[model samples]
Target chain A: MHFMTALRAAWQQRDSLLCVGLDPDPARFPAHLQGRSDAILRFCTQIVDATADLVCCFKPQIAYFAAHRAEDQLEALVEHIHARHPGTPVVLDAKRGDIGSTAEQYAIEAFERFKADAITVNPYMGRDSVDPYLAYPDKGVILLCRTSNPGGSDLQFLEVDTSKGRMKLYEHVARTVAEDWNASGNCALVVGATFPAEIARVRALVGELPLLVPGIGAQGGDIAATLAAGRTENGTGLMINSSRAVLYAGKGEDFAEAARRVAEETRDAINAYR
Target chain B: MHFMTALRAAWQQRDSLLCVGLDPDPARFPAHLQGRSDAILRFCTQIVDATADLVCCFKPQIAYFAAHRAEDQLEALVEHIHARHPGTPVVLDAKRGDIGSTAEQYAIEAFERFKADAITVNPYMGRDSVDPYLAYPDKGVILLCRTSNPGGSDLQFLEVDTSKGRMKLYEHVARTVAEDWNASGNCALVVGATFPAEIARVRALVGELPLLVPGIGAQGGDIAATLAAGRTENGTGLMINSSRAVLYAGKGEDFAEAARRVAEETRDAINAYR
Candidate 1:
């Protein structure tokens, strides 16, 4: 299925903007699941099983799996998401950026090896680095624009000359992606929910393009401000990601239920703004 | 061993500044090796074995392995280089960029999971994103400054306000990395070999720091110009990498030998300039 189509369908059908980031930290796993050989997979699949109905997307951070030597489990987790919960897009939170054939290899890692519906990519390398991912017409390519972290301003907020005149580095990225880089219309911008004003600025630049807004739960971002700034004309188009807060919501046997409760509250909270 | 110490030792001991990049593309393997389950590992280890004595460092492009779900092979390949060629440092050419704990996960992925001596990272997200990698005081962190592609100049060459004065984006990264981000004294910059003048500029900015110069071999870069522009005060700081040109130098029974020949030529060509 086309990623954009799937994403939109997920947004409408599920009535959700929530994107649960499956960042499986095995050390923080419930006592029962911790140290199990298949802990990362089991913990993540349980999370998906709990909140699959409430999210527009499931973003599995790859480093978490790779760090644990559980990439095989990540492959299985994505397959699990597909088999169990149809229509929910799986965005691999890889933030990969490289040029030419290297970029193609990464695209294959996320799109082919893991079967991600979309992937988050770094845009600092410019258009060429992202072209390979864009080549997969059905897959979504989310470019990092204004990030949530404080140090994101170190380079992202610098003034740079654009065809439209001097603009901040990230603003230039936003305008470039909105006007020139979104050739196949399969591109999205990662504008952090923490930066509501920047999100509005990005939304203004790239009208109707989806935004994967991380930094909501553990990062202390408000859904109200985010929705006010980034919602499209139809009051949609944001996949607000929450990782630590949702994934580690509980530490007992009822962890999955605790995850579902948080997912419900978060999803409904997002809809309240809409 | 400290990555910097190991790197300098390998440079002097091997009398080669060449960093042979292990980027295995299965389709490009010898006809006999093609379709074999262990083709990626077999081909890469053969290349490593062939050139183990002739390199300062061995850089394995992580995407090539992850794309093929051969990350375990990558682990074994790194182990092979370490066990077989004791002094050669392995710089995992990951180019990963993220914030905080996510960065830690990537650090574990590179430093712990693959047991790499050092890793290449993207500096676009700034100091905070790179801090976790720098936390491993002995491991080297190579940050992307000016890349070796046509699109690299798109953002890299743009004018930006530095504390010193207005300069190019890449120059800011070079300067920042030189003065501030190298507090651990484990940081290096990737100044692509394609642009020699820019390489000189980066070298001038970051005095004694090492530079990982790519874009040689298949990328059509000039070694003499690169060496002239990027070599340190002692003429021993750069680890020049060549991937495809060396890795696929032959496709028959003599493929490993062909790879070794190219590796020798590249190392010799680089040393000739020095």
Candidate 2:
């Protein structure tokens, strides 16, 4: 099935736009699960079990797993997500970009080895770097547009001379991705939830393409504003990601229960706006 | 010791600016090691041992290792590089980019986990995404400026309005890294060996900061032009990279010897221009 179509199916089936980011930090794990070697997988699966019904997808940031030397755990976590909820998509947040054969290797790593339905990429290296990922027609490629970080404007805000006159770098990225880069119809843009106006601008440029928003909950982005700017005409086109807030909702024995509670609350809040 | 200081030491000791890339691909491996599970590490370590004396540095691209689940081999290879020739710098060609805590995790992955002296990164996200990597004062951060690939001009050549007036995106990146982002003096720019003119442009922009030059071997970049345009006043400011031409120099049992022969020839060719 086409990745975008699958995602739309997931949105209708689950009736949610929340994407739980499985960024398992061992240091922040609850007390009982702290010392175990399988804590990363165990903690993540418990959350996955608790929140599978409340999300459109699951995004696992590769750095978190790679930092702990647990690539194997990440592999397992993705398998668990697939087995538990075949409807939920997995977007590996690798942010990888390179040229030629090296980019091909990264594409293999994200799609073939890790088995992600989609992956986020950095576009700094230009078209050939991203072309390899686009070759995977059934997999979505999300490029960073206007990021939520304060220092995001360092290069993103630079006014560049385009054919359509002067525009910000991020705006150029959005226009480029929407037109030239989305021949496969599997391309998505990552517009931050914190910047609702930029998100809206990106939406206007990209049409009905999904946006993988990252600055919600712990990052302090407004839910209503994000939905008002990001939703498609049918009211579902944003994969609003909340990691630390949902994963570390409680520090006690009933941590999974607390995670479920927060997941549903957040889901309902997002739905209220929709 | 600082990474830049160490690389300079390598230039003096080895008398070569060649950075042989260890991007191990099993399908391309010689007949003897074709089906071997240990092929990735074994192939790479032989390349390391063969050319350790001929080159100033070794760059093991992480995507190649991760694609084949040979990250452990990459870890061992880095240790081997350090153990074999303590003076040789390992620049892990991981073009990583992210923001905040995620960026810190990537920092740990590159410096702590992989133990690379330097790592390549994408500059699209601006300061905060790169700040975590820059925080490691003793390590080097190589940002993509003017890449060799054809698609690199898609955005890099855009004239951006900067404080110094309108300049190409790559020029702005070169200036920013040289002036603002190098308080710790650990930043370097990657200007393709293919575009000797752009290399000269970047060199003029960034002054004496080093440039990690790719596009030398398989990418059809001119060695003499690269050296002339990229060298500093002292004639030792470029780390010219060659992967396929050096790695696949031979296809037989004596492949390592052929690799050494090609590596030495390439190294000497680069030195002649310098």
Q: Give candidate 1 regions above 4 Å deviation.
A: none
* Model-by-model DockQ, in order: 0.83, 0.84
Candidate 1 chain B least-lDDT 10 residues: B230-239
Kindly list the interface RMSD, in angstroms, of each predicted candidate in the order they appear. 0.8, 0.8
Candidate 1, residues A22-91, lDDT tens digits: the string is 9999889999997799999999999999999899999999899999999899999999999999888999
Which ranges of candidate 2 are over 4 A from the true structure?
Answer: none
lDDT for position B128 in model 1: 92
RMSD of 2: 0.9
Candidate 1 overall lDDT versus native? 0.92
The DockQ leader among the candidates is 2
Kindly report the interface RMSD of candidate 2, rounded to 1 decimal.
0.8
| lDDT by residue for model 1 (B96-203), tens | 999788999999999988999999999878889999999999999999999998789878989997679999999999999999999888999998999999999998
